[model samples]
Target: MKIALFATCIVDAMYPEVAQATVTILRRLGHEIVFPSGQTCCGQMHINSGKFAQAEPVIAAHARAFSDTDWDVAVAPAASCVASLGHQQPMVARRMGNDALAAEAADIAGQTYELSQLLTDVLGITDAAADLGSYFPHRVTYHPSCHGMRLLRLGDRQSDLLRSVEGIDYVDLPLADACCGFGGTFSVKNPEVSSAMLADKIRTVHSTGAEVCTGGDASCLLHMGGGLSRFQRTGSFEGTPDVTAVHVRQTSSTDVGDDNVDHLTAVVGADDDDHLTPGEKGTSPAEPSRIQSGFRVGQSAVHLARILASTKEDPLRVQSEGATVSGGSLR
Candidate 1:
């Protein structure tokens, strides 16, 4: 398949390595990649900040860029951006009263996808370790960012892909659905709340005992990594600014996600519990866990009526930044 790479602004500036990794993984799989040099921001940062006005031109740019390109599928390493395209872009255009542009944006979104989504759903890559030459020989925990989880409704896709990776010891990310506090411009606008959330996240990540925190969204990683900085002993920059903010990094356990160590081996203390966002679906969470009760497609929505009724009357609050389409999995 011919793929158009969505080098999200964050990846272009800070974590090109992620784009490179994405490219390597795809090419090794024998897919052709096209770099649409005209591509720019996906307008997520603007739209998420409530700057929908400023987001107009960005969305148009994206529409024109991709519309001009002829590729089998457009793939992005960032889930948030892909979610914005697939889900938020139409709202952006319609809100601006650009019905024509809104239609165009929606069309583009329909054709684009998050990397793992394309791999697992379209390409039939169910086992990463078995297929992708992927080898991260370290104890790693996966954080499914809010947008990817809620907006894109991508559950288990990222985790399943990681689990398929060779040499990867995939441990369950305690409170995996909890926000990493990177809500686009949300962190800058509401710094305090963002910090509080990040602190809670740091605590959970540290408790996981995983050496690395990996996720598809760069925004969340940046927030968590920044908070980890203040606690760094020397206070030296851990990675490049964009690197610190975009690419996944080693979160400091000194304050949040770290438990401790017996010299070389790091460890998360016991007392593991399931604390997914106040509400949202979980991939068979750690037991005694609460979830968004209704299934989407695969299974019959047995209590669908009650779940819909309750959520409508008292909108179940979700702590995470995402939610997937109902019942798309069980099918």
Candidate 2:
């Protein structure tokens, strides 16, 4: 199988290892790999930010880059980006009123696949240990980015592969379905709310007591990792240091888990009666912290993501086997 790799912006810049790992796994399975240098981003950030005008060329660039390629399939490590190709590309093109571009976008999207989608759906790979040489020995957990879980509906393909990895200790992350407070520009625009959300997510990560956390989106990992790194750097940046920055886009929802999260109290307009910013309220300087710490929601995403990421790609009959260590202990 010949595959063209879509190195998303985040993976291309910060976590190229994931792309490389993806390439390694596919090549080990006897798939030929090619990379499209013209690839930059899936225009997800632009799309999500409601900047349809700015995203036109980005969309065109994506379609042009992949449409000209002659591979059996195009694969990306991030589900959100792959989902963006199918879901947002046409929307973006249509928003620009470019019927021709929209059609082109649709064709490009149809050819793309998230990493797990390619591995299981196309390659018939069910066991990472046996087929992909996935040998992570540390106890790790995975967080499914929102777009991948909701928009792409990739469902459990990645998690199944992780479980099948050789010598891996897969711990279930708590409150897995909850957002980690990194919604791209939402973070800076709504910093306090984002912080509170991240706090909840990081607590879940810590409760699992895993050495590290993993996920399909480098943007999410970077957000969570940045927070975690900040916490580690400050020995509790406000509260903790194990969480970081989050991804800033969306993906398809494929029954990966429960996607029902009511707005947090800290979120403006969460209730019918709009509320003021934490600072705007007459509450003391210290009161805002308590309000944020008290909020509890979105606890199911990680678990739901892990489960959804394991199998169920086709949505008709999806079944997968979870990976477990056989007499293999984490140090």
User: TM-scores of all models?
Assistant: 0.70, 0.72
Please report how far candidate 1 places residue 284 from its true position, in Å: 34
Candidate 1 per-residue lDDT, tens place, 182-241, comes to 787777888766665665565455444554556776566656555544423222222212
- The sequence of per-residue lDDT tens digits that candidate 2 reaches over residues 1-331 is 8899998897777655567667766776788999876878889888888999999999999888887778888988887788888888898898789999999889878988888887788878888766654555556677878887888876787777778866667987656778878887788788888886776666556455455567777667767766554443443346322332221223347656555442222221123223434555332122122123331211122121232222222111111122321111100
Off by over 4 Å in 2: 237-331
State the number of backbone clashes in model 1: 19
Steric clashes per prediction: 19, 43
Q: After superposing candidate 1, which stretches have Cα over 4 Å from the reference?
A: 234-331
The global C-alpha lDDT for each of the candidates, from Candidate 1 onward, is 0.62, 0.64
